[model samples]
Target: MRNIKLTIEYDGKRYLGWQRLGDYDKTIQGKIEKVIKLMTDENTEIIGSGRTDGGTHARGQVANFKTTSEMTLEDMLAFFNRYLPQDIVVKNVEEATERFHARYNATGKQYSYYVWNAEIPSAFERAYSFYYPQQLDLARMEEACEKLIGKHDFIGFSALKKSKKSTVRTIESISIEQEGSLLHFSFVGDGFLHKMVRIIVGTLLEIGAGSMDVSAIDEIFENKVREHAGETVPAQGLFLDEVYYR
Candidate 1:
């Protein structure tokens, strides 16, 4: 069997998320798997680097599947793009080592959240960005971002109720850039739990809006209480920007 790596990009506004749940539910994985079955006659399982929440977008989501077919990678890529829905695109395909597992071998991930910080919301970008009419303090948000960087337990910021798996993850960097009426937030992290990035972004926004103190970030980290954290922002603003592997 040959392992094939796929770099995918999707709008994800209409799908139920990345994972395939049942035959009826619309999903990114389910759509691609259906195409693969038509091409190879195998119920191939596509293992993704991570799951993106419903309505979330992705620019460079990675997945892998093993196949017994001898089709060329170029043919496979073309086949996927041809059969899959218009919203999901298989950007690239490559032959991967047998030992390569998309989820396990992934070293880190990059995610970005966008906020429309203008009084007049953007009509075209409504589906892609969160609209916040309030003016935000960029300096305060930057200070909160500094407190979130480095290794820390992020359970407070995640939606997970309980788990034995370690919630501690390393956030290498968080950058906030403002261009016109848009605010772009980027995060590079070893890993993230469910809704972790959204929650952190919400917290930062609150701090910027003067509703929450910047020092509250440290308290949330030290207390490890989910209630102490800010709301989990809307999924539409979040994007799985890239998956890192080495």
Candidate 2:
């Protein structure tokens, strides 16, 4: 068996997220698996680094699959791009070692959330950025970001009501930058629970908007209360920027 690794980019506007649901043809994984079967006549399961929620996009998503076919990497890339939908693109393909696994071997990931801060929206960015016309205090948001850095139990910021697995995760850094009318928030972390990034962003926005205090984060962490966190931001503005492996 040959282990193949793929670098992919996709606009997740129409898909039901990255994982393949039972008999669902609208998932990114399902679409790619179907094309792989057509090319190699083998049902291969592609393992993604992680799942991106529905309507979330990706710039450097990584996935791997094992196959018995002897097709060249260039040929496989060509075949996938030709058959997959226009919104999805296979950026690169390569052979991997036997023990390589996309999700388990990942060391860190970078995710980005974009917001259009202006009252007037951009025609081109309407699909890609969240439009929040309210004025935000960048200073307040920066303070909140400082509180979120480093390792902590992030269950308060996630959607998981209960899990036996560890909820402790490390966020290496959180940077906020504004370019013209766009506000960009970048998060580099070891791992994130479901809806964690979105919830964190929402909380920060609330703090910046003066609806929530900066100290509320500490309270949420101490009490592990989900309701204390802000609303889960829309999925359209989130992007899986990159996945890293050591």
Candidate 3:
């Protein structure tokens, strides 16, 4: 058997997320897996880098599946691009090392959240960015972004129900950049807890809105409680920009 690795890009607005749901064809992974089964005549399971929440997009999502078929990589890529939905495209397909487990081998990931902070509606970016009419304090937001750098226990930022999984996560760096009316918050991390990035962004929005003091971020870390953090931002604004394996 040969392991085929794939790089994918998709507009997540049309699907229910990356994982294949039971009996649900409206998911990105489900759609891709369906096409793979149709082509290979095998109910092969594909392993994704990680789960991206519903309506969350990806530009460089990675996955792998083992197959005994003799189809060339070029044919595999062509088959997926031709048969998968218009919103989903497999950018590349190549043979992977036997031990290259997508999720298990991922070393880090970079996620970006886009905000259109303007009164006028952006006809084109409406689907990819979140619109916030209120003016934000850029200085305060940048200050909070600094605090987010480095490792921290992110339990307060996640929406997962009570579980034994550790909440400590290392955020390598953060960049908050604004060009015109678009505010982009980018984060590089070893891993992220469920909804952690969204909640952190929501809390930062509160700080920018002057509703939450910047010191509240420190409090949230000390408390380690979900209620202490900000509200969860919409998934449409989040994107899995890159995944790092090495």
Candidate 4:
């Protein structure tokens, strides 16, 4: 069998999520797998780098599947794009080594959250960004971001149920930029727990609004309590920007 890797991008407006559920073909993974089944006549199983929550878009999502088809990489890419929906596009496709697993081999990931900080919404960007009009203190948010740029147990910021699995993760970097009424929060990390990025952004928003102090992050980390963190923000504004493997 040959391993095929795909670089995909999608607008997550209509689907449930990336994971395939039984025979349910409404999800992103199901949609792509359906197209694959039609093309190759094999019940191909595509594995994504990670599971993105519903309404979360992806610009550089990576997926891989093992197939016995003899189609060339170029033809495979063209075939997938021709048959897939316009919103979900296969940006690139190539052959991978036999042992190349998308999820297990990932080294790091970068996620971005967009915010529309305007009183009047933009018709163009309303679908991609979260609308929040309240005045925010950007300096405080930056300070909080500085504190989060290290390895820590982020169980308090995740929505995952109790598990023995490690909740510790390393945040590589954070960049918060504001331009006009648009605010972008970018985070690079080794890995994230469930809803970790959205929850971290929510806490930063609270800090920016002066509702939560910057030191609250320390308290949340020390106590390992989910309730001490801010609310889980909406998923529509979150994007899987990139995944790295090395």
- Mind giving the per-residue lDDT tens digits that candidate 4 earns over 21-90? 8989668999999999998999988999999878899999999998999999999999999999998999
Candidate 4: list runs displaced more than 4 Å: none
Q: Please, what is the whole-model Cα lDDT of each candidate in the order they appear?
A: 0.93, 0.95, 0.91, 0.93
How does model 3 score by TM-score?
A: 0.98
Query: Of models 2 and 3, which has the larger lDDT?
Result: 2
Candidate 3 residue pairs that clash: none
lDDT against true structure, model 4? 0.93
Question: Measured by TM-score, how close is model 1 to the native structure?
Answer: 0.99
Estimate, for each residue in 148-212, the C-alpha lDDT of model 1 and write its tens digit: 99999999999999989999999999999989998899999999999999999989989999999
lDDT of 1: 0.93
How would you encode candidate 3's per-residue C-alpha lDDT over 15-122 as one tens digit per residue? 889888897988988998899899899999999999998999999999999998999999989999999988998998999999899999999999999999998979
Best by lDDT: 2
Global CA lDDT computed for model 2: 0.95
In candidate 2, stretches whose alpha carbon ends up further than 4 angstroms from where it belongs are none
Q: For every model shown, what is its TM-score relative to the native structure?
A: 0.99, 0.98, 0.98, 0.98
RMSD of each: 0.7, 0.7, 0.9, 0.8
